[model samples]
Target: MDLIDFSAIATEHATRLKAIDPLLPPPGELPDDQGVLTAEASGSAALGVLSCEKTPADAPGAQWRALVEHRLDLRLAGPDPGTALGLLLEKWQERLAESGTERGDWETAAVVIRPSRDSTGSGELLRHGFAPVRVVAVRPAERHGRGPRRTPGVAVRTATRKDVGNVVELLLELQHYDAQFGVATVRESTERALTAEVEEVLAKDEPLLWIAEVYGKALGVARVQLPPASDWSKIYVDQSGRPKLGYLTSLNVAEQARGTGVGTALAEHAHQVFDTEGVDLALLHHALANPRSTPFWYAQGYRPLWTYWYRRPAVR
Candidate 1:
């Protein structure tokens, strides 16, 4: 068949499936909307659709943005999905040549249905190298519900200005502990004194700091700007009318306190507040290289909602 309108093709397929709703924004708008992508080539089966998403770092006022990278999706009946994926690979190679973007890690994925209904064909394509780069990366789902269960003796409490020094110290300690994992060893960062802007956050009635403590010793500290007055908060809102969820801007538990459950306690407490306030979700993102934090959040049920992409010189 002639080249199909690729841009609107996913939307059309989603519409045919009835999987998409009229109220929800068009395809690629929702954080988790997944569908199929098919090439226009005749004798080509539809390539599986990929759902792309990312979360945010638990830094004060930070927001998470989901990513959609459909350089190619081959999904159409009576055609070879593999052929379509191959075509996509070719197209991507072209992009790499034209744009100054370095090839990110080769990636590939299989189309998976939540319950495995009418999806035998899609699975097969993924098993084979339907696309170039061979989608082999396996990403964990974003965390949901409250968070990992509370760790005994680890109390998560809102921090006050008097606790600022202790909070900074814990953050520094936590960063240092991160060295074994190849992290550059945190500089015990964050300004020694709250900048004027940060001071305002502390002065506000709502909480500005979250600290995990035991016996009055702050083991870890995460900053937060409750009732986020930033664009990040607005993005968390269901611009499509989904319920609003409170934000978990940051969470940092000192090295000595990590496995002890300090981080979990802080997150759980945030979820509780969100639940009571009618907020629909609590979210954050960690750098891909930050292995320690990502697993910590996942065990708490935070699924990978989206991925934010960035590019810099490969050499430097």
Candidate 2:
């Protein structure tokens, strides 16, 4: 159908969704040139699904070798949009099968949706072979003017260019650990890519890098972006112009220091900083299956906002 009709369906969906969860961000405007598949079930308000693909090169971590992603942006409307969702997924699955995959063996089909919609569409997602892999979690900025809790001997400080080597080492440690859960991959160029990104952040006039140290030894890191710096992430978790957003880019604690409160201290420090800077909300993405991080973040007051469902290899 035309873009006008598609947008109307999406608008209707958004109207109903707000009543369900006011924090859920409105979907971004549909791309002018992308084609959308529409499904109209017997008693539904019609569902529109936009198909988009991302080559590894489109993102920094592309050099990681084993990552290819295909996405479906669903505009789900009506009282029972799940039925239409099932139909659209079925057709999309067929489209993938007929395309004949020469896309190597490292591809995944993904869909990201609000966590509140789980009951409505999750069953259909699972039936179509998709499983939750990652989540975009959120936290509000609130500490009642109190400072971050202190970890006995640990000190948190801003990182500078001189600390590049240590920062990269700690981040690499994080990537390798996440790789075990298939959330990340370590490739020949991984270090090179990471170094460039880390250096760029450190070079920023107001770099949001923090290092946790205990007696002159660095044991943890928290990378964050505040205000204008975090604007880019709005495409992932748009707050509908309601609040200023802050992003927790990455947080890593040395394996040896995992349970020693270093990570908590780092997180609280970041939250305090965000609150001080007047950031209204904080967002981050983490692996759903990570035994350690999943629980750690929940304890830090972040809960899942968007769940990314995936079917790996992207083949029928």
Candidate 3:
């Protein structure tokens, strides 16, 4: 609020941004046009920092970083005697001050920051002092065509529960290539997640675990993850105090199904369904390291939403 606080706020924002930048969105041309930007970073640093006695989270790394994805909205207000682009430098010092006070608190962090461009309200406050609070989800723009997928008959549908096993196997296959995109969710035979993952998928009315039939046999599997309702709920609130959309989470298709339109079909179909269900936004995360996933989503009309970053304070 004062001259002293911008550094603190900016520090927090930058710290939060850097910490979460790796896991959230790919940083490209900042989304100044649509009022959004995205960056990515590993959640590992955030994981170590957020490990505290309070703010009890069970699956600490996954759950806590996910919170950053949807719930990272922070704002700092201070004096803004606007010039050209340099107004931001003053804001950083103030923000840094504020964050310094809370250094030992709860492993606190933020990422995938969203900012608003309220240009209609013309004034110094609107122009000078008005730095946006960080928000979580900034989705891609309207997309009719995205990644390529298997053609219609190329993808066969699963007929029965017996098909689920083969589908799960194919899913495991894709996970090997997932590391190309910075995901390290490799299944351990020592720590078998197959049974648990399968059960969770089957329980969903919108089961992400799907079998793609080829040559009269199930050769591939793909799945979609619906982000928790809360992920969208925080962003979907209206002036009238009502929530609008539910969010989309992770989606994966088997290697065999890759160029045949399986991923593209699933994504397009999901988009149509979301539109029909009155959900206005569809969001997802992909690896920056993977050239295909990022370009693939970009082709689908998803624009840069926000950027996240990650690094340990010790490392910095």
Task: Between candidates 1 and 2, name the one with more favorable TM-score.
Answer: 2
Residue ranges of candidate 3 with Cα displaced over 4 Å: 5-142, 156-160, 181-191, 204-209, 217-243, 312-316
Residue-level lDDT of model 3, residues 110-151, one tens digit each, is: 222332231211232233333222123434324455566457
Over the full model, what C-alpha lDDT does candidate 1 score relative to the true structure?
Answer: 0.45
Ranking by lDDT: 2, 1, 3
Worst 10 residues of 1 by lDDT: 131-140
Tens-place lDDT digits, model 2, residues 121-180: 788888988878788888877623222345589999999999999899999998888876
Reference-based lDDT, residue 203, model 3: 70
Error of 1 at 225 (Å): 5.8
Lowest lDDT 10-residue stretch of candidate 3: 43-52
Q: So what's the TM-score on candidate 2?
A: 0.86
Work out the TM-score per prediction. Answer: 0.56, 0.86, 0.53
Top TM-score model: 2
Q: Which number leads on lDDT?
A: 2
lDDT of each: 0.45, 0.75, 0.40
